[model samples]
Target: MHDEYNVQAGLNPRTVREYDEAITRVSLGYKSVDEYYSNSCSCHVVQHVRIPLLCIQAANDPIAPIEATPYSDIKDNPNCMLIVTPQGGHLGWVAGDDAPFGAPWTDNVVIEFLEHLQKNASKPESS
Candidate 1:
């Protein structure tokens, strides 16, 4: 499914292969896939990301399953919200039958969240 999404997103197959090779070369020192996957330094280090985080997870996403998402940790953070949709296969919620790109729902939800954040941010702080 991820492969299909990559292809659909206009990623050249050769480019994908090159990316895989790059990762493989960089991971040569790792003892195992688990070791590579478990490395904390390898993950994105976002310190004090003040912006509100809205994580949208598709319940049926095979690539990023619900259990795989660090939702509990995200929700525990002061500035984060996790939304899980029951449908939409791994970023497959293409909006409108004739739409050229990704799902309409994705845009709608993201926009709504941003608007809400903006409105709330503009409000004067209470003494």
Candidate 2:
């Protein structure tokens, strides 16, 4: 399933189960798999975004590997910020002593980042 569905594994032609293409086409209404990917992929889409965008990704994510990160584009785009954590699993970033009863560590990080943005939003720039 990973080989058939993962974007990283789409570089080569691999055998999918019978009716896989037909099922995908019917469900998604895409003429071909390549057409679907071309329209839906964010690798090139993020570069065109004009609003502030915060992207948090885990380096150890198995579903979406760290290698798939668009580092150069994020670096060049002022509106984009990518935070790659050394440790985290997909949407699970359990941390702190009270993690079992509290929110994930990412919640704090996101709140802090948003607070910072809000605080600086009204500040006048000095030329």
The best candidate by TM-score is: 2
What are the models' TM-scores? 0.60, 0.67
C-alpha lDDT (0 to 100) for residue 93 of candidate 2: 87
Tell me the tens digit of each residue's lDDT in model 2 across 3-122.
334343333425442233445543577666556545655687889979788889999886456776888888889999999988786787886677766788888888998988898888
Candidate 1, TM-score vs. the true structure? 0.60
| Clashes, model 2 | 0
Q: What is the lDDT of residue 37 in candidate 1?
A: 46
Clashes of each: 1, 0
State the C-alpha lDDT per candidate.
0.60, 0.71
Q: By lDDT, who's the top model here?
A: 2
Q: Between which residue pairs do clashes occur in model 2?
A: none
